[model samples]
Target: MSTFRSHVWSSVGKKMITGLTGLLLVGFVAVHLLGNLTLFIPDRGHAFNAYAYFLEHAVHGWLILAFEAGLLAVFGFHIVAAVTVAWTDKRRARPVGYALVRNAGGKSRKGLPSTSMIVTGLTLAVFVVLHVKMFKFADHPSVVYDGKEMKDLYAVVVAAFKQPLIAGAYVAVMGMLGFHLRHGFWSAFQSLGWNNDRAMGPLQNLARVVSVLFAAGFLALPLYILFFVDPSVSGGHR
Candidate 1:
């Protein structure tokens, strides 16, 4: 039993952990995108402000803390597992492709994201840190609605997205995110033994569609905000 326990800490176990945590992250992204889509309400960002307020006030205390903590744990565990698996694969592989080869062919039949998962994943981690600090913790000016003070988070976000360079950077990151998700999604299923012969094609296609949607959906907000919406006039911090 002790030997079996030790063996379970090998390559397969690490990859299984990565797959499980990857699913958690996918779900988190979906929920975050749905919530953030409220920025398009065009009601001077009232809907989004109210939603944010609700999340902060009503959802405050230990419950929200626990949820946030759990998310961090999932992310930390996923990063550790993913890095471990990647390193282990690197150490065990022959030069001729007995293991991993992110860069092999010209067109890369494995696709760019699959080949660069570690890079993109780490890049996104940096993005997440900056993102949370900006929107989640940074002090910002406020807006008054019906005599009530709400964090001018909408304005803050708009201000950030309004920068051409910032907007471009965000869109580019979204592209990398799409690439990561494309490979991660199908690979998750494969790791879990769901990639049957008959299902592989459909699963891969579904992964592609989902990856594109996530990128497009997330990118749309910044594009729309920077181009179409006028935050100052739309009830943001004026």
Candidate 2:
């Protein structure tokens, strides 16, 4: 049993956890992005907000707690496993860069995608923490508009995009998230034994389509809020 535990902590085991949890996180991102898109519909943001309020405050609070616990477990395992794999690989490769770019024809950049994963994942972690801090922390002063307090979930979102800096930051983070998912989604399927030469073609195409849709859906939110909606317009402040 002790020996088995050691083997479970091996590099391969770490990679497996990272891949699995990373896939789960991808699903979470899709759900979150879809929910966020509700902001585009007039009065729909409140509906979404109410849904969020219910999840947090209702008798089903324990269910929310359980879900959050599971999410945190997945995230923690994913991060630890990713870091272990990366560190192990780094140690194995003494020299960081190779002299000649070795493109063994038909083979993609050997380490680019893997390294990019770490960078993008770290960037997203920082973004998520800051995001929760901005929106989730209720006591944080509301971004005011027209001498009225704009502090509710809907108002905070509207106020957030009103600032060019905040809007651009979200766009930038979403772009990184898109790139991360572009590689991740297909890789997840491949990991789960779906990789077959006969089906690889269609699978790859499907992955691309899903990735694009995910990116577009998320990107549309800030774009619409910033460009189309006017803060001074009616139905904005309630």
Winner by lDDT: 1
lDDT of each: 0.81, 0.69
Question: Which residue pairs of candidate 2 clash?
Answer: none
Residues 103-174 of candidate 2 have per-residue lDDT tens digits of: 113345344444588888889889988987876665632333345444457666777898889888888888
lDDT of 2 at 74: 92
lDDT of 1 by residue, 1-238 (tens): 8877665466666676788899999999999899899998878878888777777776455666777899999999899988887877678653122112222222323668788999999999999999989888889778777878888778777888889899999999999999999999988876655555567679889999999999999999989989998756766444
> Top TM-score: which candidate number?
1
Residue 89 shift from truth in candidate 2, angstroms: 1.5
* Candidate 2 regions with alpha-carbon error over 4 angstroms: 94-106, 109-114, 140-151, 233-238
* Alpha carbon lDDT at 195, candidate 2: 56
lDDT measured at residue 34 in model 1 versus the true structure, 0 to 100:
92
> Where is the poorest 10-residue window by lDDT in model 2?
95-104
Pairs clashing in candidate 1?
44-234
Candidate 2 positional error at 182, Å: 1.0
